[model samples]
Target chain A: MATIAVIDYGMGNLRSVGKALEHVDARSRILVTDDPATIRRADRVVLPGVGAIRECMAQLRRLELDAVIREVGSNKPFLGVCLGMQALLTTSEENGGMEALGMFPGEVRHFTACFAEAGVPTPGKVPHMGWNQVRQTRAHPLWRGIPDGSWFYFVHSYFVPLLDDAWTAGMTTYGLEFTAVIARENIIATQFHPEKSQTAGLALLANFTRWDGTA
Target chain B: MTLAKRIVPCLDVDQGRVVKGVKFVDIRDAGNPVEIAQRYDRAGADEITFLDITASSDGRETLVQVVEAVASEVFMPLTVGGGIRTPADIRRMLNAGADKVGINTAAIDNPDFVHQAAQRFGSQCIVVAIDAKRVSGADEPSRWEVFTHGGRRPTGIDAVSWAQRMAASGAGEILLTSMDRDGTREGFDISLTRAVSDAVPVPVIASGGVGCLQHLVEGVVGGGADAVLAASIFHFGEHTIAEAKAYMAAQGVVVRLAEDP
Candidate 1:
């Protein structure tokens, strides 16, 4: 049985993420843990987060789970959702500017001026709350069974602007084109909350469970 | 593509069971909140709001269990409201799997509660629920006044201005319900909904008095609401979420189609 460890540094909704994993695969052992040893032994790892980036990082550092995440997240089949995805970037403009795990070479920026600068119509709310379509930038395993242009539930203000297109897997338009999903070897992350994204989201999680970290 | 307008089914839970009533009176059991939430999830409800009518400490414990049950079964954003009084109450709900905490009376008691909660748990998770009643007369300046204590008392705060204040205070969304129209199914207070939605930059979930599918559409188009929250219409099986989405889609309002089961 594949054991997927959902790292619980105590910032995000760990239970829901664990429940979603359980709902997806009954055979897989969905362990919500903060112990570095348990995380290291797991076949796959998930980093989930919500709320302010500064607080999220503070908790990660306080628990010394930051180093564990850096080790387990880099080598294992990893998935990040919402703030988890944001924390993987090099830095975030939130809280004046905060350092991140830098797993993905990019910066998380607020959707403040992209719309106005592009001369597009008035963009939606700041948090960009609710469902929006994700346009797949490249083919990946996680897109299996989920149709193109399918809507996913999103609730965030800051988004990552990827410095390298090689890692960009999906993009969505809120203010302008913002990276919604990121994929590279052994990793898949999304700006949206897959646990709260309904059927399509469940499908993606199902795919993740079966994926071998290949694009 | 444009952002789809949401159809959220609200479950008023009392002591762990889903209940509904007329203007917050004569409450009766509907069904299991978790079962209903899963049904809505499969039927394509954009979100679910579980309002705990019993606001006591014991009630809070019951609601936490209810939320955990529903969260385990349903995979969608769940907003839990009803007696949230402090930042700790909000944190408890979120810890129990609620995506957002809807604050009403407590926010009215200490307006800064909204700011504090939003500041602590990102504004996206802080929703300010305003129960407003139309206070209009020929002699008086027609406006809606905020009501608390289950819509039994008036707080003298103008509905529109209060919404603006809450938004400025860091509330990410407004759950605006018209007291007069609530439970009547006459229709949502489009004028009041419009006023608040226009006043706040955040998403406004126009709630209360949704009698039919057209009201859902009207809630988004006419009321300018980002989402429509209905209780009785959905709870009583008078309307289905798929039916409502189909109705909204036909009206040229973008809505997610229910996945084939």
Candidate 2:
């Protein structure tokens, strides 16, 4: 049985993440924990978060889960959601510039100027809440059952932009084209909430359970 | 493709049972909260909001239980509204598996409570629900005032500015409900929705008074809401969320369909 540890470092909607995992694959052991030992013992790791990037990073650091995330994110079949995805980046522009885990080479940016810069007639919403189509840029194990352009639920103000195509697994356009899914070998992270995304999301989670941490 | 506008079905819950009330009165039992939520989830509801209309303090406890039961069964985002006053209330609902908690009366009473909740729980989970009534007549320029206690207590605060203030104070989304249109099934007040949606940087959910699917479309197309929320139409089986999304998609408004290719 695959024991997947969902890192619970005081982020938003951790329960929903755990419940979604159970719903997707009943046999797999889903652990919602803050302890580093249990996380290391688990076969796979899922880092889920919602809210401000600064607070997310702060909570991770305070709980010493940052080091655990850095360790497992590189070796295990790792999945990051929303703020957890942002935390993998080197830096974030939110809360006046904060340092991230540097798991990936990028910076999290806000969505205010992107609308005008993208030449959109009306300035898009800041949080970028609701369902948006995620275009698969490259094939990965995570994209197994989901179609190429499937809608996923998103709720965030900041997103990682200007990513290298090598690391970007998926691309989604809001006011401007932003990297929604970033993957590097074993690590896969999404800007959208897979737990809240219904059919496609459930498929993604099911894939994560069986994945062998390969590209 | 662009971000699809969301369709949310709201359940007015009173004491664990899903109830349908017209203008917060003439209540009738709709069904079980979990069962209806499951139906909406299968029908491709972008989100679900449970507004607790229970008057007694003891009955209010059932809201958390309902949220817990629904969250366990349903996969979509769930929001719990009604009587969310303190940070503890917000924490309780979120712990109960609600993705977000809607703040209506408490926010009207104290705007800083929104900020405090946002600061503690993160703005993404804090949905500030505004109940607005048209204070201006047909002849007068359109103006809306904020109302509390389920649209009965008028605060005289301008709805647009209040929405702006709430967003500025760290509200991630605004649930804009038109008291004038709420139970009347007249449709969302486009002017009110537009005013609030344009004023605030956060995403606005145009809610209340949805008689048909076209009203859902107008909430996004005409009103510029990021999401549209309706209760009775969805609750009473007048229309499913799938039907609403299809109509919106046909009307050139971007919406996510259940079987989208």
Best by DockQ: 2
Q: Who wins the TM-score comparison?
A: 2
Candidate DockQ values, in order, are: 0.59, 0.78
B-chain TM-score for every candidate? 0.96, 0.97
lDDT of 2 by residue, B124-207 (tens): 899999999999988999999998877878898999999999999999999999988898898999999999988988899998
Cα lDDT tens digits for candidate 1, B20-60: 98988888899998889988888889999988887567877
Angstrom error of the Cα, residue A154, model 1: value is: 0.8
Worst 10 residues of 2 chain B by lDDT: B252-261
Q: What's the lDDT for candidate 1?
A: 0.88
Residues forming the 10-long window of minimal summed lDDT in candidate 1 chain A: A112-121
The 0-to-1 C-alpha lDDT of every candidate, in the order given, reads: 0.88, 0.89
Give a tens-digit lDDT track for model 1, residues A1-215. Answer: 88999988877578888999999999899999888899999999999988899999998899888888888777888999999999999899998999999888768888765556677677677778999988888889999878888899998878887446788888888768888899988989999988889888999998889888877
Candidate 1: where is the Cα deviation over 4 Å? B139-141, B259-261
